[model samples]
Structures are given as structure tokens and as C-alpha cells.
Target: MDIKFSGVTKIFEPDIIALEDIYLQVDKGEFVYLVGETGSGKTTLMRCITREVVPTRGQISVGGNLLRKINRFDLALFRRDIGVVFQSFLLLPNLTAFENVAFVLEVMGLPPKEISERVSEVLKLVGIWRRRNLYPPQLSGGEQQRLAIARAIVNGPSLLIADEPTGNLDTHTADEIMQLILGINAAGTTVLMATHNQYLVDTYRHRVVEIHRGRVVRDEEQGRYELNGGC
Candidate 1:
């Protein structure tokens, strides 16, 4: 899905501005990295795309749908086409890996047979089929993350958003997770990832959008993690 933000600004009451006149465009099937320090509005930007928060000013258009124009009744329908992953993993402790992945389909009211097939397919795709019967507490950090990815993609979303997905993993495990994410992108899902890991950003060399103090500072294709004169 293509995303465009034009003159978008988000403000919190009592004089806090989370974003200021931001302009960005992400084409379909592109993998874009949102790089910034803590509280630099990266997460807020992702939230805008997900419609968790509306822009305080200007407009945001996702796949040609104007966010400001979407009614409350259609919000859930709009979100179904987008997938999101967070640093926390956010898996239910009581559910097995397979069940966790299947839960999304169930919520969407898919047929039982179809849910089984999709859950199985995604579990194997993320290389965690063997652990499908294990609960989240039983899996390693990397394994839990893989299961999270499986759940995120099980519904076949056209756009995927990952916020600091590798923040808690070691170098090797982080690399593995990134590889899985890249593989998902290669299979034609547009990915927008928010991250602060310089090594991963430099090594992967994707398009990078840098935000600082609620404003976009730099945007570069095949970009490295460079603070330079800008933050």
C-alpha cells in the first residue's frame, strides 16, 4: 500500500507537538525505515498510519483513502488490510503458537478449515512449525518474535508496520529476525519499520526517513545511519 503524508502535524495539549508539518510518501512494495531517537515522533507517525490517532493538522492518505474522511464505522474494515508488529511481541500467554496465530483468523470469522491452513502455512514460513504446540513462555525471545511475525502476516495484509522489532534481541537473533522481515517484504508486502538500531540500518541499506524534534530532517534512498549535522 502506498502512504502519503502531506503537511501533517500532531499536537498534544498543553504545548506538546509530536509531529510538525511532516511530508512523506512510501510507494507500494517499498521497505522504508523510520530512524530517530526516543520521542522523535517515529512511533507517532506509525500510529497515524494505523489510524490510532488522527492528525491534529493537515492530511494523511493511505492507498488513496484519506484518513480524515474515514468514518468510525469503517475504521475496523480499514485496519484489516494493515498488519502491525511491536517490540513487546504481545502474544497471549495462555495460547499455543499455532493457536495464537489462528486467533486472528478466528476473530475475522474465517472458516475453521481455512484458518487451520493459513495458521499452518505461516508457522512453517517463519520456521517455527516445530514449536507450534508451545506457549509463548516456552519459546525463546527470537522464537516468540517469529511467532509474532507469523500472526501479523497470517491475515494476508498488504501493508506491514513493525516498530523496533529487534530492539530486545542479541546481534545474531536480531539479524535472523530482520532476515525474516526482509523475506516477507520480498514476497510483496510493503513494510514500514521504526527502529533505532544503527547497525541494522547501515547493513540493510533501505530507504531511511529521519525525524527530529517533530520534523523530518532527512530522507535518503539506500541510506546509512548518519547523524551528521542532523539528528
Candidate 2:
């Protein structure tokens, strides 16, 4: 799932410019890290890709489809090809882990049997199969996050976007989640992760795109976590 942004700018009400003249591209099967400080347009950039918010100016293309031209109906269809995991682990407290993951496939109108199979597969892939019956409140922070990742990938999406997916966990658990994300990417899913963890960014040594004050500061192949330097 290739993503391209050309001269993109997003301005909120009054005078807030969330992004400015942004140009970026991520090829298929690439694991790209989007790193920045709080409110530095990292989340805004992800929102643009997901179409949660439209850019005030410029164009974005995902998997060859222009975002500006996609109608609401077509946009809904386009979103199914992309998966998103968030820092908050937005799982339903009333639903079991299996049910939460299966809900995505259910919304897509898949057959019950197929939904069950796919949900089971992804839960196991994320190492949470044994806890499928647990509810969100019953699971630990790491377990809940794993469940979130399972839900995100249950549809076999071509692209996966993660926004601070490890922000709530301890170092050990964060490392585990990072490993799972890497494994998912290894299985051919294009990954774009937004995070502030410098250690993970430096250790992984993947392509990094750094943003600051609504502008791209650095983009590097096998990049480290450098805020004050350019690649």
C-alpha cells in the first residue's frame, strides 16, 4: 500500500496550521516510523491518511487512489483496506477479546464461520489466543493492546497504521508489542507507526520521517532518532 502526500497543508480554525507544504511517500511493504513531539503534527498526518480529517490544501494518494476525489461511499470502501491501531486500545468493555476482533469482520458482512476463523488466527498471531474469552477490563495493558492489534489486522488489510501503540506500557511490554508489529510487517503488511519512543526508533533503524511545527524536518533511510539534526 503506497502512500503519497504532495504539498499538503492542514489549517484549523483561526490560525492553527497543523501541517504545511508536506511532501512524502512510502512504498509498499515499508515499515516507516513517524516520530515527533506532542502536537507536532504527527497525529494530524495520520488523520490525513485515514481521512479522519481532510487537508485544507494539497493532495494525498493511497494505493493509487486520490483522496480528494474519493466520495463518501468509496471512502468507506477504501478504509477497509487499511488497519489502524491506537494508543488508547479502544476495545469495548462489554465484549470479549474474540468478539471485539470479530466485530470488524462482522461489520464487513462476512459469514460467522469465516469471522470466527479469522479472529482466532489474528489473536494467536498476536499471542493473545488464550485470552480470547477475556473482556477489556479483565485483560492487562499489554493483553488489551495485543487484542487491539489483533482487531486491526483481522481483515488482512494491506496497510497498518499505528499511533503511539506502546505509549501505555512498561519497557518490557513495549518491546514485546514492537516485536509483534515487526512480525506483522514481516508478513507483508505495510506499516506506518507514529511514536515518541526514541529507543525503539533508534534500535529498529527503519526509515524515519520526523515532523516538527507542521513541517517535515528529516527523513532518512535506516534513520536514528535525531530531533536537532538532518539526515
Candidate 3:
């Protein structure tokens, strides 16, 4: 779970400079936030780490692979170290919640018996086992997001990365999602979240990496969200 980024930059053609010379690291089991206003390279940074898009320059090494250069052939092995949950929940609409989670294990070619057990465990951990038979449309926003979290973790990856995980939910639902994520971190999964929810920052007080423009402006241990009006 050693994630190290140094001098990383991503510039799309037509000159949209998303990130510039960014550097950061998160060791195993640390919960941290990448906070900023929209278009502040939060998603771009996540993409760079997960190798959805390559960095235009510099290096991003996670778990042992050089993300900038890993070929598609090697990607599956690389992804095995990390889990990602996006704001959209990204569940398969046709699959039941259990199957949505079970899909990951199936991809890894795990035995059905083990996959079933792990999926059950993760659903319970995310507080959605009772709803396992339900499809995406039948669940509430919070439940959908929880299912996303469950799906992300069912593989038991070393790092968990989430982006705007509760952006669409009501404050209470968002808080519940936050607590579930915090609980994941508490149970020894490293979480690196990209969020704009300042209240969650003040309330939970984890480490924070504040991204302004395209750079990491602050990396605070025991972080207190210093917004326009203080936290």
C-alpha cells in the first residue's frame, strides 16, 4: 500500500493542464483526503494512480508498479492492490447487490464458495446484507453508495480510493456513508478520498491533502478544515 507520487503532471491535448508537479505518499492503513473545489485535479489524480489515464510527466508508484508505464497486460495485477468507489455508485443495474460485489471475485477467478463467503462478509460490513437480493433501482442513494463501497472492498485490497463518494446524498445519508468509510479505514484499510464536503473534514479530522489549482497546497496531519469561515 505504499503510494508515492513525485513531480506528477497530466496535461490533456488542447492544453488543459489538470495536475502539475504533484507529490504525495500514503503508507499502509492511513486515511487521508484530497480536498478541493471542482476541477482541482482530484479526479485526474485518482485516474493517474489507478492508471485509467497516464501522467504526462513524472512518476506515480503504487504498491510496487510504476503507474505511468504499466501496460494494459499488467493492469489487472496492479489493480488488485487497490479498490475504488466513484460518486455514481457504478453498480451494474441488472445485477443484485450480492452479484455486483461477487463480480470482482469472479473476475479474480476465485472459487464460488469463497466468493460467496467474502461477498456476504463485505455486504454485512457495509450494512447492506439484508438488501443483498435487491437491485440498484430499488435501493436508496445511501444504500446504493454502500453497495458500491461493499463492491469495492469485497476483494480486500490494500488501498481504498473514493471520489466524491457522497456528493449526491442528503447530509444525514452522506454522514452515514462517511462513517462507513471511516469504519473501513479503522479496520485497517487505507483510504484516500477526494471530497468537497468540508463538514466531514471538521468532524472526522483525518489527514488531509488540500489541492488548489493543480497542486497540493497543504498536507496536514490531524487536519482541521480551514474553510473561508473556520471549521
Best by lDDT: 2
Candidate 1 has its poorest 10 consecutive residues by lDDT at 222-231
Give each model's whole-structure lDDT: 0.91, 0.92, 0.87
Model 3 agreement with the true structure over 1-231: per-residue lDDT tens digits: 878999998899989889989989888899998888788788989988788888888999988788767888789877876899986778999999999999999999999999999999999988899999999999998999999988888888889999989888889988989998888888889899988888888898989888877888888897876632212
Cα deviation at 169, candidate 1, in Å, is 0.6
Task: Please give the TM-score that candidate 2 achieves against the real structure.
Answer: 0.97
Candidate 1 residue spans exceeding 4 A from truth: 228-231
lDDT by residue for model 2 (1-231), tens: 999999999999998999999999999999999988788999999989999989999999999999989999999899999999976878999999999999999889999999988898899989999999989999999999999999898998999999999997898889999999999899899999999888899888899999998899998899988785223
Ranking by TM-score: 2, 1, 3
lDDT by residue (110-142, candidate 1, tens digit) is: 999999999999999889999999999999998
Candidate closest to the true structure, highest TM-score:
2
> In candidate 1, how many Å is residue 128 off?
1.4
The weakest ten consecutive residues by lDDT in model 3 span 222-231
